[model samples]
Target: MNLKNKIVIITGAGSGIGAATAKLFGTHGAVVVASDINLNNAQKIAGDITEAGGIASAIKTDVTQYQEVEALIANTIEKHDRLDVIVNNAGIGGKEQLKTAEHTHDDWHNVIAVNQTGVFYCMKVALQHMMRQGHGNIVNVASLAGLKASGHNLSYSASKFAVVGMTKSAALEYARKNIRINAVCPGFTHSALLDQLLAVSPDMGEKLKRFIPMGRFGEADEIAEAICWLASENSKFITGQTITLDGGTSL
Candidate 1:
């Protein structure tokens, strides 16, 4: 889709799906703000976009902290003078979660802080601006685990479920404000982190694939495409929806 001159802020844009989405948006003529806790990586992405004749900038932000996220939006507006899109893509799956009785409390807190609270912060701040401007697009990156219970990753599942719920509730509240809100729930996808895991245990990657109806992991760019469509004018009528791109894993 043509995103000519649209101003987009993407959190966790240093790597994985966030990076892919930022690059894709830049390719389509959007001015991209690539924010991540890892400043160096974010800078690398921004540099890549600049080299390719796209407008972009890197900003260090820890979405888990409200002040940092607020500053991110402030800086974006100060530089761009407007916010067209905010992608709440900063999230964490945490270390493997045990059963209710065995799970560490810190793991639950950490996961919820980043995945749930962080999304809330981004949405709250962006809405204040979007409401005044009379239009915007907000896309929160949820997960297949959000739609279903993950016995082994309870904290991650809980955090993402909250994201889906937030997306729906917020979307309803702002449906008529010309601001569209939605969530993208993806299944097991290939990424740098997944690469590290597969490198350590190659067989586990193949084994996990059997459970997906598509018999393979979805690509990061595929998920980015869904996000782009939802943010584009083509899907202006699509709000308050959870678009699942999980290779039918939820089915």
Candidate 2:
């Protein structure tokens, strides 16, 4: 994919699929803006890209905060002169394995804030700049739960389902303006978020793996590849679509 000189902003880029996508985009000649809740981790990823002879910068952003999200876009535009693409990859999982009745209000609101509302904030800000530019791309990191009923976590599922809906609605609204919006629904991927779950239930990984026909957990890089494609012109005709990379588990 030809992403040369494309200014791309990736949220939650400190680790997991976000970090992997930053590195991949850098290698493909995109100027990567790595944004995360943790400044240190974002700096490390940005530094790694720079060390590899690619251009990148780090910004600390809490996507759950609209002001912070606004600053992230404004600062990127101020430095780069134009915004090309935004990967709404920042997200959080709620209390896992909890029944609907067992899920707390705080957990639901917190998950919705980061996963759903946060995406809206990023999209809202980026859309303004992108609309003026008359061209842009938006790649949202949703989850398998978003595409189907995942009894794992009520709040997480609800929030992600909202992402899917938002992506499609926004894509149709912006298609004529030369902007594309899409999402990726990854299933059973090995990410820091998943590691946290494993920390709590060590055998969960093996149990989840058994459901996948591939019999292995996905690597972050695997998901990154798809994100890079969606951000590139290679997928110019594709929008309002959720690409699933679950190793046949969804089947």
Candidate 3:
């Protein structure tokens, strides 16, 4: 599906899945607004997109902060005049050293603040604009752990699970208003952060792969493709659902 002229905003566009999605969308002819907590990283991605002859801009935003998120959306609209799509992808893996029972309140709140609450905050403000225009699409980047138990990574899993829950509710709420909302569940995608996680336990990586019938870790591009499809007219009939790019690991 073509998204020529569409105005899209992608959080966490500095790296990983978000970065991949922004480039793909820009190449597909969408005007992408890349937002990330890291200004340098966001600017680099925007530069790459521009060099490739795509329309893009970088916005440094801390998704967890309401004021920052509000300003991010406001600035996008001020620049483009309208917003057609929003991908809430900014997130973290949460405190690594802490188990469920050992997690500090600060760590737990921090993960939820960014991963779950941030998605909701974005949707709330995005829909305000979308509802005004009477058309829009939203895609939340959740994780496979949202669908099932992901022992040891309690806060991240919990936040993602909340994202899935919120997406379903929001999707139904806006469907009649001519807006579609969905969630993407990706499994063990390779990212710059993967090496650090894998170092914790080499066996965990192997264990994750074995769960996937494809016998390999998925890539960020793989997940980005699904995000694009859901955002485009190709999947107009789909809503209140999640597209899993887990390589059959969820099977």
Give me the candidate number with maximum TM-score.
2
lDDT of each: 0.90, 0.95, 0.91
True-vs-predicted CA distance for residue 60, candidate 1, Å: 0.3
Determine which window of 10 residues in candidate 3 has minimal summed lDDT. 192-201
Per-residue lDDT of 1-251 in model 1, one digit per residue for the tens?
Answer: 86889999999999999999999999999999999999999999999999999999999999989999999999999999999999999877656536778888888999899999999999999999999988999999998888987776788889899999999999999998999999999888888645744664659898778889989999999989999888888888899899898888887
Error of 2 at 31 (Å): 0.4
lDDT of 3 by residue, 4-42 (tens): 999999999999999999999999999999999999999
Per-residue lDDT of 234 in model 3:
95
Ranking by lDDT: 2, 3, 1
Candidate 1 yields a Cα-based lDDT of 0.90
Cα lDDT for residue 238, candidate 1: 93
Candidate 3 residue pairs in backbone clash: none
Each prediction's RMSD over C-alphas, in Å, is 1.4, 0.9, 1.2
Which is better, 2 or 3, measured by TM-score? 2
Candidate 2 wrong stretches, greater than 4 Å: none
TM-score quality measure for candidate 3: 0.97
